[model samples]
Target: MSEEIKVQLTATPGEKPDSQKLGFGKYFTDHMFVMDYHKDKGWHDPRIVPYAPIVMDPAAMVFHYGQAVFEGMKAYLTDSGKVLLFRPDQNMQRLNCSNDRLGIPEIDGDFVIHAIKTLIEIDKSWIPTEKGTSLYIRPFIIATEPCLGVRSSYTYQLIVILSPVGAYYSGGLEPVKINVESDYTRAVRGGIGFAKAAGNYAASIKAQENAKKDGFSQVLWLDAIEKKYIEEVGSMNIFFKIGGKVITPAINGSILKGVTRSSVIALLQEWGVPVEERKLSIDEIFEASQQGLLEEVFGTGTAAVISPVGELHWKEHTMKINEGKIGELSQKLYDTITGLQSGNLPDTRNWTITF
Candidate 1:
């Protein structure tokens, strides 16, 4: 390991995938950024090396107790050959937030961004340039300490990898049907639900799989205690428009602080659209839909950017939002965010950084 980011070029690079059919996260770049940490010495020995499988102890804390955190981001290739990243700073910042929640040592957000940008530059040619494709950046930290105790690990490893991903959903920008989860809970108010912890996603697999079996694209979660108040939809933060007012769940301890969610909120507020972040209940959403006030519903996150919810199935009721069509707001948001990401729209908000 090197004290600084010492780059090791790979002897053989992978063949680039077809841009048109590059499904999500199937292809990876040749190099990755890695760093290690110890309790006595703190975080040290940062380096960029050829991507390879990591050997870990059987009793590694991450495998045993799941003390790990990760961040999801992307790099886009414009028609002019310019590479742009959408809010890399926010992703790094949120990674630290997840670290704090999971009892992992916080990382320097600046250093993480630098390592990510350098890795992207080294594999810049792997970025896809189809109608809807980009290089997916995944930065994660795992506890490497070989312990079985129910406490934080004393050692850690940080790794950043690049994947050439197409659409996160097969529908692309099409609206999706969501099934509300009734049995399982994603996270509790006092849990690591607000953080991007690995266990949070791991715990959601059963419910998500059930939803898929029932012919739904994703699952909508409610509060853990009462299990009635709206929380989130699968991996994304959800939003709705009722009577022309944009509303999303308030940033409670259970909701992950989404970068794209924040951007959408800011854009709506700046554009003078009535936007509110509060505890919105499913009953209220259904009432609004029944009364013809539910104008739109969408989910925001790094992977999909904007996923319109055309239909929602709760308990015994199925509500169609925006007549099962993509709402005007959803379309506009998808166009705007993806436009700025690809340099098709001017980044007036300074959210995109050209690399």
Candidate 2:
């Protein structure tokens, strides 16, 4: 553990919400981890304090320029009364990748993971114990330098917060309808699409809200230039099963490198399942559906884990996948991944970091 992190306990604790009905990202714990950065001092002074609003200058670079990045991770309460963190080191490592892309200073991944475990131990009671419920951990960085210039800021702050949550989708494990976004582009070549930067998400809000207004769950984005190649879903990496093979959008510069997506690929390869990560355009997928070759569709991420996509609505055409229900492969993957997370199945790959 890093001795640099100072701890300040809260004098009066807040009442814990009912774990059964806890929604995603709604309720917070009592404490959070914070660290600061600067051009002169570098990254220093890590601490834990009560969960409260942050006070920053109005002219902060993040407020003006949106030079920020973040990561999503989770801590699960196992069936045997133990706690485990699933691939948190990978998430923190990805956060640094985002920092590099955004010109922000890098934070210590190992120390940050250690601090997360420490904070979880301190507020262990905040972990939801209901089935499909776990503690969602968000680690982020913002440009704190109070400047209005369009250049990179030298000052930054690293923050880690925890939320006790239920399933990400309201209809857990059920198939969801997704609309292919055609109005706005999420990323293009040589853009900041691969990073978990805030701007990428900001660009997606309009399309997502529109999809929601049209009654779809999420928006599947396409590449910026070609406008036909699949990039990624709004909140998750997407997958498709066609002609006895599993294919996903290749990690171009426009797609976020997902830890869950990588793990899924590893598991499929380990089981000798034919899984390919390459450019499978929407035209090809829709054609596959027309020819009765598209078998299943799903999404992978830290929040939803494995969200089965039952219906995909393209431009003036709707395709029903796997009879508008969860496919067999989707169910198996969800069961296996969630099993490994909660220690209900064998974790042969050592992905879960138990604290």
Candidate 3:
């Protein structure tokens, strides 16, 4: 049996129904889970408190140097009135991986899982039941020690917050147009790119904004050293299909090891799709597109699940993939993954943990 954690809830006053109209991450729940760690005391004083503003000193390490990491996952409400978490253990493991890279102390996986379950139980009503809607959970750790020096902090804070989100594709499952960023690099070898650190995302906002301004939805980043191989899209891991085989870039030191990406590879392999985890070059994909052999291209992450890529722009040249429409494989992968998540399909991989 899991020990129940205490919570102090304070509901938000005059909440709006407009959240349904706006999509995900626009609205937050009334409460949040928090825990603190110290060099001498370790993690202590865990609690679920009202969602409120946090005060930090100007010299806080997170403010000065941006030493923070975060994970994105979801909680689903099934038709049977049961709540489920999709592969939370994997997220916990990944969080530790990020912590190790950031020089933050590792946390016990079981404790973190228990904390999440407790928090969700206290805020169950905040979860939406509409199709393509779920509670988005963000778990993050940040260095909070108040100091001006450029080093890791001795004090750390971890928090979990929930947001009710609608479908990522409001206009339906339409594919996206992505611009290949050959000039700017999102991550480099021997860098903190593999971790879910704040700096990695901070460095990407400008590029993403530029891409959006140019009528592209996202930027597909290439390797830093050679700027040849494909790495990932803005916040998701990318996948390509050529000649009926699924190929994604290998998990080099620079690429983030997304849970959704790993799960997709596992699901595809189980369905007899030849999945390759190796270096995939932009040149190869462009050649395949020119030869009319590129069948599909999509990105995977917790936020969008699997977003199809309709077009690719590389260095003043643009190529349309699958005639600028969603591919069959993309739809199949989305349906299968969403089905399993929504409890409409069999939980073959035992990916869901019920509450």
Per-residue lDDT over 1-355 for candidate 1, one digit per residue giving the tens place of the 0 to 100 score: 2257889999988888887778887889999999999999888988899999999999999998889899999999887887898998998889888998889998888888888888999999998777778899999999999989899999999999999998766556788999989999999988999999999999999999999999999999999988888999999999999998999999999999999999999999988999999999999998998899999999999999999999999999999988899999999999899888989999888798886
lDDT for model 3 comes to: 0.89
Clashes of each: 0, 0, 0
Task: Determine which window of 10 residues in candidate 2 has minimal summed lDDT.
Answer: 165-174
TM-score of each: 0.97, 0.97, 0.97
Model 1 RMSD in angstroms: 1.5
Model 2, 12-63: lDDT tens digits are 7888988777888889999999988888988888899998899999999998
- A best-first ranking of the candidates according to their lDDT comes to 1, 2, 3
In candidate 3, where is summed lDDT lowest over 10 consecutive residues? 11-20
Quality of model 1 by C-alpha lDDT: 0.91
Model 3 lDDT, residue 282, Cα = 90
| Residue range 1-355, candidate 3, lDDT tens digits | 2334568878653263454574878888888898888999888888899888888888889988888999999998888877888899999898999999999889877888888888888888888887788889999999999998887899999999988899899777889999999778899989998999899999999999999999999999999988889999998999999999999999999999998899999989988999999999999999998898899999999989999999999997788999999999899989988888888887978899888
Number of the top-ranking candidate, with lDDT as the measure: 1
Q: What do the candidate models score in CA lDDT, each in turn?
A: 0.91, 0.90, 0.89
Point out where model 3 deviates above 4 Å.
1-4, 11-16
